[model samples]
Target: MEEEKMEAEDPNHNNWERRPESPPELPAPPEPAAPCRRRCDSSGGRALLGISGSTSKFLMNVITVDDYRSTYWPKLESAIDQLLTQSPGDYIPISYEQIYSCVYKCVCQQHSEQMYSDLMRKIACHLERVSQDLQVSSPAHYIEKFNLALGQYMGALQSIVPLFIYMNKFYIETKLNRDLKDDLIQLFTDHVADKHIYSLMPLLIEAQSTPFQVTPSTMASIVKGLHTLRPEWVQLAPTLFSKFIPNILPPAMESELQDYAAQDIKLQQELMQNGFARGDQSRKRAGDELAYNGASSCGSSQGYR
Candidate 1:
């Protein structure tokens, strides 16, 4: 066997070629791949933008000029510049939020109340057209969709009181495009004053009771709305908010209810304690069972011996 091994090791005896080491085998080079940008066709992107983008779009659509300039104008300018680079005034996938922001800025004027009436009408019409797309689309399409849902859901718990509170803050703190101010007033008169802003009034009050606070300006504005428009909305107002007048409301409100905060904290604490206690008991029981079994086995072994 040793002789055969020696024979095999003999350099000239077999397939051994005396050569310097060949280059290490390399993995085959990967082929070039196409770039996969996050995009859809013009209309498809627009359709997706509907659900995720509409709330921000709608907020932009309704905000006054000063509000836009202060809160959103810079972002709008950047989006527009990028949009122009892609396809002139009308980019195929221009977001609903972008379009609304641009239109609001374009038509707004500092002192005049006439510029936006026509524009507002156009916006309302456009919103109606996009309704089908917006209603059915997914929320993940836009970055702001979750924020919007969170806002709406939180608002719903308190009957959407926060929306009005936000509206009030923007209205008084910011000098609006006069046209938008008037338009909002008119729209509110038509929709809320004439009907059931008060129907949800009780729910709003209940939410307010939860320790959710309001800003001074915001609170004042709500009072103004209630005092001025209560009569118009009374007949249609739901039973809950009727207490708006009978009860002198609190001077302020919080962003979220206090009770909800308390409950959430309590639940978290209970879960943590219960989990810890259960785990501790389980470990102790297992240790005890193991010791008992060991003791019983040892006694049996001694008796057998």
Candidate 2:
């Protein structure tokens, strides 16, 4: 027994101890499957998905796969419904104030030049009706009441006139729809001739203040109106000249007393030109000095002097 135990304990004895069990091998990880690509319909199917052609095109050009479900896909669905709606205007869930706000926004915050033109044309048409109403009614009392209401409405919508004018001018300049431009210009001219330009002063002021890229049709009217009305400092020049400068203050009663403005813009322009020339000369002198110093650093003698 001692011998057997000694043999079992021997370092090189095969029977001394059971062979150590081989380590179990782990199974290889299953191959990752290729991701499935979603095939979206392209031929007007995207339109059915509620995406506007423009939005769809933009999405296709710029949107990524990860963002599709989150941003583009939802918008696409909404766009489809909006596009297919028979009357989106009717569907718009807004209050009366919101409607007015939208109208005002169309006038004041219009982004597209074409949209602005359309809005101005609509406003001009409304104004034409108002002018017609003013013309047909012979009673001063009725006219006064009507004028007050119309003035209030115009005042409320005043914020957008500049936008309308801008689009109108762009349309005219581009000759996009010359007939509309001619008609609108004629309408404005007639309104000025009728001496109703005063009523539009509030809107004119707001319009002039807009820094939009498009030029206001009101500018042409302003220049011509100014020449005709020769409004003093306080008085509003004809609506045509509403483009001369922003209306900082309302036409005062004092305007009725004066025939012309005291300050001559032409003279101011000349003074500005002189100042600009002086400034240019000063800058040139400074630049020359810098050049002279640079030359001096190189041990060169050349200079303006």
Candidate 3:
């Protein structure tokens, strides 16, 4: 009775008969906070990640002009040289994909203009070297050497175009409003073709006059190359022949025709047998047809047909 009275008086006192206390109720789980929306910078740049503009700029390792020239241009230039110099059977020092990535990075780093200019300068330098070499070649071998160099340059360009496709799209086509391949071809015209046109003209005339002096395929390539370099010439009246030939060969045409006429049927047969003719026609007939076509075309063109 005394203990019960004491427990009642002191509420803090424990009693064995009392029920165990229940665990305190946990605070209701907090409602999930709404997701924070990312905000893009005013300049249309990437979304900010709590970083100040200056800090973001500082963090980016933007390549400078000098940095690109020193770090990347040399490697790209070396790859181009390898492509231009290597023969079909030779080993390539750099892979096409590596060169392409280099160009792509340059363009991405805001060096598109510099990269474009550098490539143009490099190609111009190469054409200048080719021009110098051609200038020293003997007349007997001039066309052959020119054709070989042209083929090499063209082949190298085919490889280069794909490698620089990004730069071509971003810088060349967009900013300069020019086609890379066309510009390169123009460089060839300015650096090589124009410089040697006078000397080459006589060779072309001689080849035409003397049937076997240059193979027909070689002649065709020369003609096609000239036409390709000066597409505007195609707009001229005599679309049948390379316009440069007509523009330059007017004085020699009559003489060339006379010489062709004087050649025997045996010469014509030889020409036809040598794949000069277009199809399975008789050699004599094809040769006569070729002669007639040549004469008519030459007659129609004031300068070139």
Candidate with better TM-score, 2 vs 3: 3
Q: Taking the tens digit of each residue's C-alpha lDDT, what string does model 3 give over 1-305? A: 43343234334433223221211222211111111112111212334355566754444334568767776798789877877776544455454444554565556556777888888999899889999999999989999998888777777776777677767876777767899988988899999988987787677777876667887788777777767777554443233344334454344455455544444445657778877774655656777888876775455444442
C-alpha TM-score for every candidate: 0.22, 0.25, 0.62
What TM-score would you give candidate 1 relative to the actual structure? 0.22
Tell me the tens digit of each residue's lDDT in model 2 across 1-305. 43343233232423222211111222211111111001111122453456576854443333334333343233323322332232312232212222222222222222224344444555455556766666565442332434343333333232233322433443334445553334544544555324554544444455444332114443444433434333452244333243344443344344432222222233335557546332444556777877864554332111100
Q: lDDT by residue for model 1 over 1-305, one digit each (tens)?
A: 43343233233333323221111222211111111011111113324444445643432233456554554444434433332233112222323333332333332212122323333453344334333333454533321222232222222223112212222223322435233334444444444333434333453455344332333343334434555534444344323233334333232234334443454455446657646232445556777977865664443232111
Q: Which stretches of candidate 2 lie over 4 Å from their true place?
A: 1-111, 158-305
Residue 91 C-alpha lDDT in model 1:
25
**Cα-based lDDT for every prediction:** 0.34, 0.36, 0.64
Worst 10 residues of 1 by lDDT: 32-41
Lowest-scoring 10 consecutive residues by lDDT in candidate 2? 32-41
Ranking by lDDT: 3, 2, 1
Rate residue 14 of model 2 by lDDT: 31
